[model samples]
Target: MRAVVIESPKQLHVTTLPDPTPGPGDVVVRVAGVGLCGTDVHMLAGEFGPTVYPVVPGHEFSGEIVAVGSEVQGYAEGDRVAADPAVYCGSCHFCAIGRGNLCEKWGTIGITMDGACAEYVKVPAANLYRLPQGVDLGHAPLIEPLSTIVHGLDVVAPSVGDHFLIYGAGTMGLLYLQTARRNGAASVSVVDLNADRLAVAEQLGADHVATSADELDRVTTGWEVVVDCTGAVPAIEDAFTRVRRGGTFQQFGCAPDQEQARFSPFRIYNDEIRIVGSMAILHSYGRALDLLAKGWIDSDTMITHRFGLDEYQKALDTFSQGTGRKIQIVPSLAPGA
Candidate 1:
């Protein structure tokens, strides 16, 4: 099997490795598509916390099952599937309470274990969701990220005709904008430092888009719901103050470990504001796939670039440049590549 291994920070190598055999309750998937996420970039830069070295870094992926574990019953060979990368200990307190996303012994694929940047990757059979007949393999990888946004929206519970202010115009922010509109938000505004991303937000149904925080005028203030997708400390801080009194502020981004932000404690109490931190997807994977299958989420327009397994460095460079929306890695190269 050929895999792209991150030997160290800022380094990647495409090397041959032994193919994985499915263990008990596991499935070996022939890698089809892998989406490059900010977490992958952070791992490459040694910014994300406590990642094992020489790991194949990719979790957002979809593929066909080539081998199934002896104990697996619901899945078999030739099943097209998308996987939930978050491996949780079923007996943990969080898992007991149905909050498996916060499982105590959570070990994510591609982060703590071998990921999908290879010819074949092994995953727990329990994590596999069979892709619908018409869903393209290329678009199946988007299920993970889309699920995250769905989970966030579930927590915020934005009402019809509610005003929304979304910070950042990246994939997550743009997806949230569309989801909010679908959920019946009458007016939505997206803010980002990148003009190009803001433009995409506009196309996705954001009523107003701005590049600077200062450009958020009085009319944009007092939004019923404000979402921070930038994961930057400054933006998170701004969100706390910008949301209307008694409104909801959703932090959907992951900031650096050492980053910190301060807010007015008195105002939080006085305004009766609700501050919610939405982490990874919680029971939203199936719903996300359903939406994708129904054409509610458009992966074609969101995915801007694609590269073969051999072009790992090129893919990383293009992603770092932030020239496009989403970059994808095709693990199996085409003929003559």
Candidate 2:
């Protein structure tokens, strides 16, 4: 088996490794496609902590089940599936309350555990969801991130005919735009410092796009809802001020652990603004898969590059350049291709 490992910050190496086998109640999947996400960049930069060195780094993925443990039921060999990388302790207080994403002892594949960046990866049977018929394996990797956006929308409850202003035009931001539009936002606008990303956002159905933070004033301040996907301090701070007095503001991006944004206490007290922070997907992976399987999301358009497992370093370099919206690693490529 071939796998990509990050020994340390700024270091990605592709090396031959032993293939994985399923444990009791687990399944082994032959890697089909693995999506590179922003979190992977953060992990590579040593920003996100608790990532084990020399670990395989991928979570958003799709694959075919090659082996299933005897204890695993309702699944078998040759089944096409996508995985929910978030592993939660069912006994935690959050999990007891049906908020597994917020579980105190939450662990995730590709971060806290070895992930699907290799020829074969082992996952708990409970985490595997059967892919819908007719859904290509190439696009199955998108279900995880798309589910995050769907979870955020579920929390914010953006309604029909509402005007939405989304900060950042990156992959998550663009996904938010499409989700908001699908939820019936009369007009959805996206803001990003990168004009290229804003163009991509417009192509994805954002009614308006802004490349400048100051340009937000041109749009109505009375936006019905504002979502911040940038996670930058300045952008988060601006979101607090740009949302309408009574509008909802949702924070869907992850900021640095040490970074903080200040807001006026008086304004928050007087404006009646509702601010919500949405974390990772909570029981939304199924819905994300359903949407993808049903053709609600154009997953093919989101994928910009695909590389063989042996080309993992090149994939990392391409991801670091920020030129592609989404990149996937295909571990089952034919020899010499």
Candidate 3:
């Protein structure tokens, strides 16, 4: 087997390794494609706290089951699936309360364990969700990130006619826009630093797009729901101010640990604003898969680039440069072939 290993922060290698064998409760998936996301970038930089060294960094993936564990049931070889990467310590306080995303010993595949950035990777059978018939395997990786959107919206719990203001026009932001529209948002507006991304947002159903919130038509009271998907302190801070009185604001982005965003505490108290933070996927995996199957996401437009396992570094470079959306690694392909 060939895999890309992040030996440590700032160090990586593509090398041969023994093929993974499934445990009694796990299955080995023959890699199809893995989506490259911001989390993977943070893992490579050692910024993601749960990341373990020498790990294979890829979590958003879809593949065909090649080997099933003896104890696994209701699934078999040749099934196409996507596994939820989140691994939780089931006995933790948070897990006991059914909030495993906040588990004390929370970990994720690709960050803490070996992942699918290779020809084969082992996954817990319990985490796997089979792709619907006729779905493109290459597009299935979007389901993982889409699940995060599902979780975020669950936290927002917006009214059917509420207006939405989202920061960032990248993959996450755009997905949020589409889903918000489908979820009955009165209107979805987006802001981004990139004009190209803003354009994509408009094409994907955003009612308004701007480089800054000041440029958009101001709702008399403010947007009913404000979401920050950039994870940048500036965006987060600005998003807070856009929330209408008594409205909700969601921090859906993954911000750096050392950064802080400023907000008016008095305003929150006086306006009765609701502030919520959405972490990774909770119990939304199946919902996300179902949403994708129902055609809620434009997977064709979301995925923009693909690379082989050997081109992992180049894929990282492209992702960092914001050259494309939803870049993926098809482990079975040869480099530059």
How many backbone clashes does every candidate have? 0, 0, 0
Writing each residue's lDDT as its tens digit, candidate 3 over 69-89 gives 999998999999999999999
Alpha-carbon local distance difference test for all models:
0.86, 0.84, 0.91
For model 2 the local lDDT of residue 310 reads 82
lDDT of 2 by residue, 1-337 (tens): 8888888888888887888889999999998999988788778888776566768999999899999998999998999999999999999899999999888887888888889888888999999999878889899898999999989988988767888999987778877888788888898988887888888887888888887545665355568798898778899998778878878889888776567899887876788888899988897999988887777776766888888888876777887676777888888764336
Which has the greatest TM-score? Answer: 3
Question: Which ten contiguous residues of candidate 1 have the minimum total lDDT?
Answer: 212-221
Better of 1 and 2 by TM-score: 1
Tens digits of per-residue lDDT, candidate 1, 1-337, equal: 8998988887778899999999998999999989888788878887777567879989999999999999999898999999988888889999999998888887788887889988899999988999999899999998998899899988888778888999988778877887788888888899888898988888888888887656766445678898999888988998777888889999888777667899998988999999998878888999999998988776787888888888887888887776787778887775226
Residue 211 accuracy (lDDT) in model 2: 77
Task: For model 2, state the Cα shift of residue 46 in Å.
Answer: 1.8
Q: If candidate 2 were superposed on the true structure by all CA atoms, what would the RMSD be?
A: 2.0
Which runs of model 2 end up more than 4 angstroms from their true locations?
A: 213-220, 333-337
Clash pairs detected, candidate 1: none
